[model samples]
Target chain A: MRGHFNYLRPDCVTECLDMLDQYGNETAILAGGTDVMISLRTGVKKPRIILDISRLPETRQVEPYGETVRVGSTLTYSELIDHPVIRQEFPALCAAMGCVGSLQIRNVGTLGGNIANSSPAADSIPPMMLRDAEIIIQKKGSSRIQKLEKLIVGAYSNTLEPNELITGIILTKIKKGYRESYQRIGRRKSLSIARINAAILGRLNDSGVIEDARISVGSVAPSPMRMTNVESHLKGRKPELKTILEASRMIAQEIIDLVGVRHSTEYKQPAIAGLALKCLEDVFLDSSVN
Target chain B: MNLEIDFCLNGSEIRLSIKPWETALDVLRNQSGLTGVKEGCGIGECGACTIIIDGKAVNSCLILAAQLDGRKVETVEGLEVDGKMHFIQQAFLDKGAVQCGFCTPGMLMSAKALLDKVENPSTDKIVEAMTGNLCRCAGYVQILEAVREATCMKAPLNKDDVTNS
Candidate 1:
């Protein structure tokens, strides 16, 4: 808060994109202001100009596009939770968003802000990855799309340019055979960052055999990543209790191999396994039996 | 850099020239003279700075004054109309929900936001809405009772019983 900065509020997305082009690295896009305000007050980020794009109409739309649902970058967590398309097709994403801060925080925090902040403990990223989410990045005149996994390179880092803005996120609709669950372990029930979280989406065939499995875990590595190895192990297998327990163990082992042993490994190893098992069971075992 | 922001604060349209670094909490408390909004934590973790912005309860500490452009902001000060206490305030007083009284303003705002959306919220809905506001005095039982009481009230207490004090 020590530095003096000019604030610009653009009413439309094109005007905001023009401001970003004019200022480049000297400007920071302010969406939701949940993360940017804290960084500004703590002197962690000092930009000469702040382009407030939270109110841009083009970046606030939540609608269906062909076979996928598109969420505007400025759409808040509350909006996402209440959107009909999101509630019906992406329950895992809804569950992940519900675990974010408190009601007050959710009222102002946006999914794009959560993605751009790129916290490894971000509750939304794991489920977003499960849906094969893609980010649409916009510059002044042109825009490009990139897979969500590729957009985020590491912890608190992404490939976005200084003059670029995230317009929206595209998530493929969950089909009929797919079952999903999101589970997280936090220090407390509310307003705590996740210690370990998992998002599982599996497609079951007529005989209850796994046709496809997609699993993603957060806070276990430098970034939230899809567990392809575990997914491969679970595919074509029955989602019985024993099979899920073994697949859960594989998820834990995958984390160890990726992040290696750390001081909190003893607790996290079992916790990750248990969380993954719970998510899988919630989606596959519980739903199928009912 | 000073910027002029025009917004509706507690049913009044006001314009203020404030520094871009000033938060909504600072503007409300220092400039607007609305001390009902407290700042327990400068960060967004605590809901002591809760205010209703466009019918949503948000932490004022996390919102910059510049972001209030053309928006409607309601605080605990706006709860009463024509010198009469809002039913929620009356219920809080009757139920003895205030102990230290630090978190009451924020708690009232959160409760009002919930009631505005749902005429009769379930117990789970009430708890979820009130989770953000933390009362260190451990008066949650009475606070819950006050919200429930406010939901069932037939009429306001009196026209002159409660003032802006």
Candidate 2:
């Protein structure tokens, strides 16, 4: 709380990019300030210049191009949850965002901030990864786009340059036949970090056989990762109770292969299986049952 | 760095010179003489510093004072009109929802935000909205009843009337 920093609010993306270029390593870009404020207060990070991009008009929009949607970096969880397009087209993403911090946190925590922070336990990343999300990064005079999986290089780290800003996120639209579900287990329901979370999207053919599947899990590895091995195992298979149970076990095995045995693995191993089963059931079986 | 910020607090517009690091909770309690905005947790975990900023309930502790520039804020001090307490405040008193009184302001703010959006929120909705504000005194049962009671009262002429006084 006894730190000295200069705050700058830019009206447009151009102005913000200019400031980022000028300040470079000395500046910190703030979206919602939920994470940045905590880092600043705990002495985890110290930046002389605080560039406030929460109010920039350029990063506050949600637009659709062809079959993909581009979400502004400053869009808060509340805004995204209430968006009709997101709620209709991406129920799994909406559900994942809804599980973010409490209502107060959702009102102020931005999707961009969540991505930029790159916490291995971030609830939003797994859902976005399932949808094949990409982020648009901009520096002073140029810009580039990177896949979400590639952008986040490690825990609490990303490929973003010191002078670069994440302007927005682009998500591929879910196909009409696809059904998706997000499941998370935390210490408690609200206001707690996820111990493990899963996002599953699958398509079932008319004959009741799984045609395609995408799975992503978080908080079990160095970063939130796509479970391609599990996805491949489930694809071209019928989504029966036995298949789901096997897939659940595969999810546990995948996490073990990624992070090996640890203090919490004994608990997390079964918990991951249970969560994966729940997510797959919700997307493929529960709706038909109920 | 010091900067001048103009914001509306408790239905009145005011300008002040504040540091970039000063939180809105600090400015409201120390500079603006509004001590009702308590700081149970300096971090955003606790909602003790909840305030209405542009019709949304937010933790003032997480917001920078400079971010309030050109914005409107409403703290617990704004919950009275013509020396009479708002209906939400009265319900809290009648329902015995104020224990130790530290979490009252924040609880009231969160309730007001909920009632403003949903005139007759279900019990589940009420619980969901109040999840952020915590009371270690274990007064949640009565707090839940108070919010439910406030919903049955006559709707305010203007939603801001409960907080813009």
| Per-prediction TM-score to the true structure, in the order listed | 0.96, 0.97
- Residues B1-165, candidate 2, lDDT per residue (tens digit)? 579999999899999999888889999999999999999997877799999888888888889898999998899999999999999999999999999999999999999988878878999989988888999999999999999989987365555677888
Candidate 2 local lDDT, A78-196, one digit each (tens):
99999988898889989999898788888889999999999999999999998889999999989999999999999999999999999999998889778899999998888889989
Instruction: Specify the highest-lDDT model's number.
Output: 1
Using Cα atoms, each model's DockQ against the true complex is 0.69, 0.71
lDDT (Cα, tens digit) per residue for candidate 1, span A1-290 = 44678889888888888888889789877898888888888899899998888888998998798889989999999998998988999999999999988999999999999999999999999999988899999999999999999999999999999989999999999987788999999998778999999899988888888888999999888889999988998889888899999999999988997898989899989999999999999878976685
Poorest stretch of ten by lDDT in candidate 2 chain B: B153-162
Cα lDDT of all candidates, in order?
0.90, 0.90
Q: Which pairs clash in model 1?
A: none
Predicted model with the maximum TM-score: 2
Q: Judged by DockQ cut-offs, is candidate 1 incorrect, acceptable, medium or high?
A: medium
Model number with the top DockQ: 2
For model 1 the local lDDT of residue A24 reads 76
